[model samples]
Structure formats: structure tokens, C-alpha cells
Target: MLLPRIIPVLLHTKEGLIKTENFSNPKYIGDPLNAVRIFNEKKVDELIFLDIEASKLKREPHYELIKKIASECNMPLTYGGGINSVSQIENIIKLGVEKISINSSAISTPELITQAADRFGRQSIVVTIDIKLSGLFRKSYKIFDHKTKTTSNIELLTHLKKIQELGAGEIVINSFDKDGTMLGYDYNLIDYIKPSIKVPLTALGGASKLSDMTNLFKKYGLIGAAAGSIFVFKGKYRAVLIQYPSNKEKKLLYSLPYFIS
Candidate 1:
């Protein structure tokens, strides 16, 4: 079995890196470049820097900041947010980003995925789905629209399959309900969406610790284990503490049996 890549998911705004709860209530964390420098020393497997405000503001990614982060980062980086065109993808690649994640744009214009994949190769394209479960039993998928600033009525699995068909190399399932809760990931959501696409899938949001990642990887066999709060904060108070598991801890995590009994 292929070991899943352990990734630190960092949120970006005009201010800098921040953490959020349920995708709202933003709390300032630290500088993005400072975080990158720390992660570089830790030798993290990969990094995900998402510009949370870019899509909502309908602006291109902060290219200068991204370039700075990429230049300082030693590990492979995956950037998402405000990417809506082929030129943006080309430029991000030129800046040394290993992958480009398209969320709102993927839902708004799926052909962008195909176009990007055709030009940059499917392996470089990652589609992110920010979904929420609502109503009785909390069992429906809600697609949040950055353009309309509302939840879209689009069906969940249909969009997942569409992203796959468009030739994305990977899919990142980010949970709106679980964002920053750090209770755990939405396992039911993963189980529901697993069979719909063939590409590697990564789970994001609500991962508070290493075991959460290990359990998800063991249960779903994901290609990437990504989290934000667990790496950026410490303790129940959510104090600012950017940390990553040491190399020894990561090795132990990957060696665990497929099923922990």
C-alpha cells in the first residue's frame, strides 16, 4: 500500500495565515512565510496553502506572496483559491508549485480543469470540494458558492464525477461542517464519495491530531492526509503553535496495521 502524504493545510488571507471555525470566525495565526520556513525545517511531506479570500474577493491569487512562499518552501506545495484560468495555472507552475487546486472555479466552469490538465498534465491539477451537510441527521451535501456567496443547489456526487471526468489528478474533500472543529473528519462523507472517482483523494478540515489522520488513512486508504488546526494551534484554547509530527512519529503512523483493533 502506498503511504499517504502528510500535509499541513494553511489558510491565507490578505493579512496572513489564519485559522477558522466552520469556515468562519477567522483568528489570526501567523505570517505565511514564517510558517513556510518552519515547515521547511520540519521536512513536511507536502504543504497546502489556500487563499481563503481570493475566490470570495474574485481576485487572482496573491502571486507575490505565493512566489515568496514557494521560494522559501523546501517541500512540494499545492496552492488553491482564485485560480480561474490557464494562464494562472501556468504562472503558478512557473513559480514552482507542484499542484494547483481549483474549487469555486471548478464548480463554476469545469472545463477549466480539462484545459489545465491538457496543458499542465492531469497530475498537476487538483479539484477541491467544500461541502456541508445540513438538515435532519445532517446528511445532505451543500455546495458553497463564492461568487453568489450562498450554498449552491448542485448535487454532490454529480459534481465529484464531473471533476474526475474533467481529468483532475486529485480531489480534496474539505468539509464545511468540520472546518476547524478539529473533532474529526467527516468519515461518512468520505465513504459516500470514495467510489465515485478514481483519482487520489485527500481529506481536509477538522483533523485535531495525528491519530485522526492515521485512522482516516487506515479506514479509507486516502492518498493524502491534510489538516489545518492540528498543525497550526496547540491545546483546547487553540493557542498559536505551528507544529508537525517528527519523522519518528510519521514512520510509526505509517507502520500501523490497516485495521487498528
Candidate 2:
């Protein structure tokens, strides 16, 4: 049986680490490099470093910092932000990173999904989608041009299908309304994407407790699940002390009948 995965998401504002609620108000956590060293010692399954400012500034990912991170950290590292081209993904893969994930760039340029997948192989490309709840009916909301705040998810079903056809290996469905709030994963995202794509999927945002995660395994057939807030903080207490469930807790969640069903 494949062991379920737990991942930590590190957000970067220029060069510092931060956290947020519903993707707004990113609070500085600490130096990202220092945090990586700590997670390295803790034996984390993987690390996701997303530079929130890279795309907004139209600058490439800070590869210099990435190289040091990949070298020092024992786990596989994946980095995103400002990734908009074929050569850029290739350049990052060459630097010892295991994968390259893209979101805003793929949204703006539809062809990037196919180009990156074809050049790097499907397994190396991860497509991340950031969504929010739109209206009283609780529909998924997609944002285009984060600067202008235009919103829609009407094109999402079609877009997800296109990326799957384009050879992308995995998808990460993130909820803008739930990030760092640690309430739980957006369960509806599973209903939204389950029918369109035949690829491994991971859900992030709103994962606050062990029951929240157990509910995810019970409700969704997602191949993997992730939470930055739950692994890094405690409920209402809101401390920076990092935590992960012991081996037994992981077994209970992974072996639940709902997970296999």
C-alpha cells in the first residue's frame, strides 16, 4: 500500500515566510531557509515553497535560494510562482528539484500546460488551482488577474479537461476562502473536478484537525491530501510550534475503509 503524504506549504513575501487567512493578510512566520532546515531535521515528507510575490513582480522564482534549499533539505522540494515558460520549468528541474508547479501562468496561457508536460514528462508538472466560494449557492469561484479581482469558475471544467489531455500528471485544488483558516479542505472541489480529470489530485486549505482530514479521506477519492496550517499550528492556540501525528494516527487515517472505497 502507498503511504499517504503530508506536505507543508511555505509562503514567501519577497524573501520572508508568511501565513494568511483566505489568502489575504499574509503574516510573516520566519526566514524560509531556516524553516527548511528545521523541517529537514523533522523528516517531513515534502516541502512546497510558493513565492507569492514572484508573479506579481513578474520575476522568475528565486532559484539561488531554491538551490540551497534543495541541497540542504533531505526531502523532495517543489517550488512555484512566476513560472510562465517552458525553459523556466526546465531550468528549475535541472537544479535538483523534483517537480515544478504552476497556477497563474497556466491560467493566463492555456498552452503552457501542454508545453511543460510534454517537455518535462507528465510527472514533473503539477497544475495548482486556487478557488473561492462565489455566491449564496456556494459555487466555486475562479479569479483571473488577481490585481483587478475579476472572478469566475465557468471556464474551470473545460480548463481542467484541457490540462489533463495535455499530459499533466497531478493537480492541486486550493481554496482561497479556506487557506490558513484551518477549518478543513474544500470538499466541493472534489465534486467539481472528480468527473473531468483522470489524474492524481491533492486538496489544500481549511484542514484544522485530525477529524477534518479523516473526513477528507471519507469523502474524497483524492490520491493525496495536504495541510500547511494543521501541520504547523494548533487550534485557536495559534502557535508556531510544528506538529505531525504519530505513526498510529497516520495508520488510522490511511486505513479507514472510506479511504480505499
Candidate 3:
């Protein structure tokens, strides 16, 4: 039986590794390399490192730093931020990275998605959509533009269908409101968006415990549990700690029924 992949979504700025609440107030956590080493030891399913400043500053991905991280990672690594061109995607893949996540570029210049997919194959290209709901009823999908520091009015389901047509291998649906909240995965958002796209989908933000992951997979079918705060912080005080599920914990998690219906 297929198992839902559990992934840790690590964020880094120019300063180093950090965490954020609702995509604001980034708090420094620890060294990126150190976290990768620990994840390697824990045998994580996969890892995602996103440079929060890359798109805001309009700079290329830090290839050297990515190379360093990829070298230490025992599992597949996916890197995002400032990835605007096909050449950059090729370079990142050359550094032993398995996937390249495109966000802002995918919105502004969507052709880059198709271009990169053609050059590197669709499986190597992932699109991450940061979303925020508008108004009390949450009727519309607001696409968060990190570079502009504003949200765009786009229909969530329509945008996702376009992404699939663009040949993206996977889709990461990130919640702008729930990021770093550690509340739980947004089940309503998953249900709303899942039927539109056929590709592998991953949910990030608001994942506080292993049971949250179990619940997501059991109901959602094949999906990825990508989290930040829960993996790095512990207890009420939220102390910084690098951790992952033990081998036994992982065995039980993967063994859960992946499809409920």
C-alpha cells in the first residue's frame, strides 16, 4: 500500500533558519546545516528548504548553500525561493536536489513552470501556492505575493487547474493564515482544492502533532504532511529542538489507512 509522505518544511532567510507566524514576524531558530544533519539521522522521508528572502530580493537560489545542504541530506531535498528561470532549476537539480518549488515566479511568469518542467521533467518541478481567505465567509482565494507583500484576487480552484495544465509534478497548498500557528491542517481547504487537481498535493502550516498527519492521510488519500513549527518547537514554551518521528513512530504512521473511501 502507498503511504503518505511526511516532510519537514524548513525556512531560511539571509540570517539563517527561522520560523514565522501567519507569514510575519520571522523568529530565528537554528542553523540550517545542523537541522539537515539531524533530519538525516532521523531518516526523514524528504526535506524542503525555502529561502524566504530569495523572491523578495529577486535573487537566484543560493546554489553553494543548497549544495552543502544536499550533501548532508540522506533523503531527497526540495529547494524554493528566487527560482525564476529554467537554468536555475537545472543547476539546483545538478546539486543532487530532487525537486524545485516555484511560487512567485509561477504566478508572474507561469511559462517558467512549463519551461522548467520540459527541461527537467514535470516530476522535478513543484508549485507552492500561498493562500489567504478573504472576508468572514472566506468566499474568494487570495494569492499571497511575497515580493509585492500583497495578496491577489484569484479563484483557488481555477488557479490550481491552471497549475496542473502547466505540467507541475506536485502542488504544495500553504496557508497564509495558519502558517506557524500549530493549530492543525486546514481540512476545509484540502476538501475544496483536492478535487480540482490530480497531482500529488502537500499541505503545510498548522500541523501540531503526529495525529494531525495521520488524520490528513486517512481522509485525504495520497498527500504529504509538510510542517515547520511542530517539528522544531516543543512544549508550551516552544523551545527550539530538531526532531522527527522515531522509527517505530514512523512505522505506525505509514501503516495507517491512506484512503478512507
Assess the local accuracy of residue 233 in candidate 1 as a C-alpha lDDT between 0 and 100.
88
Per-residue C-alpha lDDT of model 2 across residues 93-152, encoded as one tens digit per residue: 888889888888776786888888888888888888877667667655564445345565
- List the candidate 1 regions with Cα displacement exceeding 4 Å: 136-138, 146-149, 257-261
Question: Candidate 3: RMSD over Cα atoms?
Answer: 2.2
lDDT of 1 by residue, 17-116 (tens): 8988988899999889999999998999999999988888888888898899999999999999899999999999999999999998897789999999
TM-score of 2: 0.90
Every candidate's CA RMSD: 1.8, 2.7, 2.2
Cα lDDT over the full model 2: 0.76
RMSD of 1: 1.8
Rank all candidate structures by their lDDT, best first, as comma-separated numbers: 1, 3, 2
Q: Which stretches of candidate 2 lie over 4 Å from their true place?
A: 136-140, 143-147, 256-261
Model 1: weakest 10-residue lDDT segment is: 252-261
TM-scores of all predicted structures: 0.95, 0.90, 0.95
Report lDDT per candidate: 0.87, 0.76, 0.87
Candidate 2, residue 164: the lDDT equals: 85
